[model samples]
Target: MEEPVRWGVLATGKIAESFARELREVPGARLVAVGSRTQASADRFAAAYGGRPHGTYRALVEDPEVEVVYVATPHALHLEDTRMALEAGKHVLCEKPLTLNLSEAETLVALASTRGLFLMEAMWMACHPVVRAVADGLRSGRFGAPRQLHADLGFVVQVPPEHRLRDPALGAGALLDMGVYPLTLADLLLGPATEVRATAVLDERGVDVDVAVAARHGEAVSVSTASMTSASPRTASLATDTGRIDLPGDFHHPAYAVWTPVGGEPERIDPPEPVLGSGLGNEAAEVGRCVREGLGESPWVPHARSLRVMQLMDDVRRQIGVRYGADAAGVAT
Candidate 1:
């Protein structure tokens, strides 16, 4: 049997906790360490997740036992946190929206490539079995040339003004946190967008409260919306002239999908239940395999694809007037 990969979690936030729960269920994976701003926080996470607690992120990355680091920091910190792990000679699986902008993502990608170390965006949605099945169907012409795509993800957040989700300095916005899901789905089925047009409503702190995006890809077009001020259907659909594929509520983490033939009844498709923890295990397993195989990037979420998505986000931000400090500093805010 292959040895389990030793993992280090670099944040003690909600997302990091979620990943730790799923990490327990992934075979050939071990949670070796967790780092947080406070020793107490790190100790709490480690006690629950089975890892050594490190008060500082630097200590966690520098630990010899940690083979990979999962970056669960807020969007503003992704680039620096990921770079630190890489420079420390550990592979990385960063959370979605790899960086605040394309330039920062490119820097990380280049660094990973140069070092010949594994690095992948933890876009759990892309690694899902059902999502993979959908990609396969599209590739095999099951959908017959996707003509249009529609997706939305949104939820109302009633938090204080200083909450990370409402703070521009922290890279809080619907587009970065929630909008990426629909945009990613669109990219998967339709390829790189050729044109993008977007509009948004910003909160008092200048972070987007709601954002709507429309883009043209090849001959196909996609429409996506995300909001932190309201709840939406949180679904997605890919339509062709002859059929349509529907991903029900929370399409980003869907368990089932439906395909409808033109003028015919809808047929549902479901992948077998995940073998381990809730969907995140798929990406964890994938990362383990990539590291063991000596691959620098995942095919499921390639560096170029990540760059493309970042570029799209940049365009959207420019149009929506959601500027971060990183934009001015030429780094991820």
Candidate 2:
């Protein structure tokens, strides 16, 4: 049997833990090391999966036995961690909202291409069975051009000003954290964005608490929204000239989605695997497959698409006055 790819997980945060847990379920993958800011955290994360605990991300990146390093840190740290891995000649799978701003994302993309390494944003949603089904429908014209789409992902969390969700230094805001989901959902079906106009509510700390983004691409239109101070779980739908598809609750990790044609019975889509438990693994599988194929990017969550999404986010931020600290004017340059 072929050897599983040696994976080193960087960071011991919630996303890091979740990705590591999901990696274990993916075949042809093995978690060999974990790196954390603290030795104790690294030890704890590694002990769970029989991996070596490295005291710093550099240690994990430089480990010759590790095939790839997964950067699961906060959005602000994505560029740094991914650069470290690429500099170390290791492939990388960086978490979503790929970078804090478009300039940062552009730099990372150029680096990855120059180094000829496989770099992908862990937009696991694009790899899930339900999401793929939607993509297939749109591509096959089953949904008749999918002229309309509406998706909202928001929740009310007690985020103080100091929390990452509210910290300006961390790119804390609904647009970066929760809004990326709906925005990416728009991109999945709408293709490249031609125009975008949005409005948002700002927090006392100057971060946006909620943002509603309406994007237009020729004849197709998509409204994607998110809020960090409210509860809105019953808001996921896709419409075309033919009909609308209603995704069940928890649209992010849906078990089954219903497609309804114009004045016709609703058809159900049941995915073979229940991605609800650890959907992160699906993207990990994509990374492994791309590596095996010697591809620099996965078609599911390609680096180009991530950059486009970041560009869209850049526009939304400009509209809402919620800019990353350094880029207060939100200049792309």
Candidate 3:
């Protein structure tokens, strides 16, 4: 049997905890360490997830036993934390919206390439079996040429003003946090967006609380919506020449989808494998497979695809008048 891939988690936030917990369900992956800004936070995470705890991210990456680092820091810290791990000679699976903007994402990708180390944005949706199956069918014409698509994700965010979801310094906005899902889904089903236009409702602090986007992807068109002030259906649908596919639940992490041909009854399609622990474990499993194969990036979530999505988000944010600290500092592209 292959040895388990040793893992380290950077940050002690909810996402980090979710990743750590789901890592357990991934075969050939083991949590080895966790790091947080404070010892108490790291210790608390370790106590629940079973890993050596470090007070600093530096210590976590420097741990000799850690083979891969899951950078779970907020959007603003992804570039710094992922860079730290890469520089420390560890592979990385950084969370989505890999950095505050496109320029920062390019820097990290370049660094990883220079070091010949594995680095993937943790865009778990791309690794989902159901999504992959659907995308393959669409690409292969099993679903015919996709014509129009729509996806939405939203929730009533009740956090304080200083919360990460409401802080511009942290790259907080409905577009980045929630809109990326629909955009990515469109990319997977249709293609790279050729044009994107957006409008948003900004909060008192100038953070976008709601956003709607219209994009053209080659011959296909798509609409994506995201919000922090309301709860949307969190659903997605694709209309093609021959049929339609619908994800009736949280499309980003869907368990199943319904397919209906132009003149046929709807058919339920399930993921090829059991969704292990909130489906987050699927990405961890992909990382383990890629690392074992000595790959620098997963074909499922390639560097180019990630960069393209980042560029799309950049366009959307620019149109919506949402700017992060990185944008203000001229670090965004």
Candidate 4:
């Protein structure tokens, strides 16, 4: 409702810090407060972004000066935090995988609709110009219809078994963390998958460390593999009937992508003018643009689309037997 959208951050983790730094760089975005479980962390993050410190999420959400809340908590906590922010009558921008399951995601969508609130999932890559160009090209009939897709996102999960990546309580695994990006990419372009046949490498702790999923969208198929045990970095590529789109290392961040047509030289494309700078701030820009336009969600990463992706993730969990402690305790879906 103001020149700069007042942002109330709900965590002090590395992602929270990185996103807050980006918000500072965006012209019409302002970091108003940083909230954490502890006051010290809040103070530190607020100081970093030149904002006030809130000792708890409640304090930040109820702050009159804050227009929106960015939920940067772990995967398992996304549902609860986003619900709290929406209930408080503040717009919410939550992290990916939206929720731990499809049911919770549907609940959030209904709640936002009932409450007249704006909500979005932070699939920042989808908001980038590179991804938009690819989508537009596909719809323009220039790239032709999408046929097959190959995507891989893996990282070396070098942490103790007690860490979140290993802790079932935190909803840790390769599918929810690394796999979401590639799966989302396919969903954004090729559309909803009717079915998925998957296989995975379950670690000794009963957690799936390596997962391979192949989904069918009518005749077109999308395939992806994700791992928490590999030392190799990560990579993602998209192939269409007309040409192939190549994304460099760290595919999530906006970068140079080559569009190679059949038997033709590749052309390079970048983000548009408004978001042409470092891709880090694209999500913040999306939030501001949507709010300015009086829209309830972003076309780039809509809440309904996020819910569909979460269902895919839930299906992946069902295919593999990676149940969290909360699920065991009947607290999760």
For model 1, give the 10-residue run with minimal summed lDDT.
324-333
TM-score of each: 0.97, 0.96, 0.98, 0.94
Candidate 4 residue lDDT tens string, 1-333: 368888989989988888888887787888888889999999888777777899898898988998989999988898899999999999989987787777778888888889988889888889887778878888888777788888788888899987768877777889988889889988988999998988899988778899999999887899988989885446667787778888777777647678889899998877555563456588888888898787889999988679888878877777787676545533223
lDDT for 102 (candidate 3): 90
Per-candidate local distance difference test: 0.90, 0.85, 0.91, 0.83
Mark the regions of model 1 whose C-alpha exceeds 4 Å error after superposition.
Answer: 272-275, 329-333
Specify the highest-TM-score model's number: 3
Candidate 2 residue lDDT tens string, 1-333: 777888999999888888888887898989999999999999998888668899999999999989988898878888888899999999998888889988888888889899998998888889897888878888998877678888998889795677788898887888888888878878888888799998999977778888999988788898888988888873679888998888776687777788899999999988856563457888888889899888999999988789889988888888887766557544632
Order by lDDT, highest first: 3, 1, 2, 4
Model 4 residue 39 lDDT score: 93
* TM-score for predicted model 2 compared with the true structure: 0.96
At residue 333, what lDDT does model 3 achieve?
30
Q: Candidate 1 or 4, higher TM-score?
A: 1
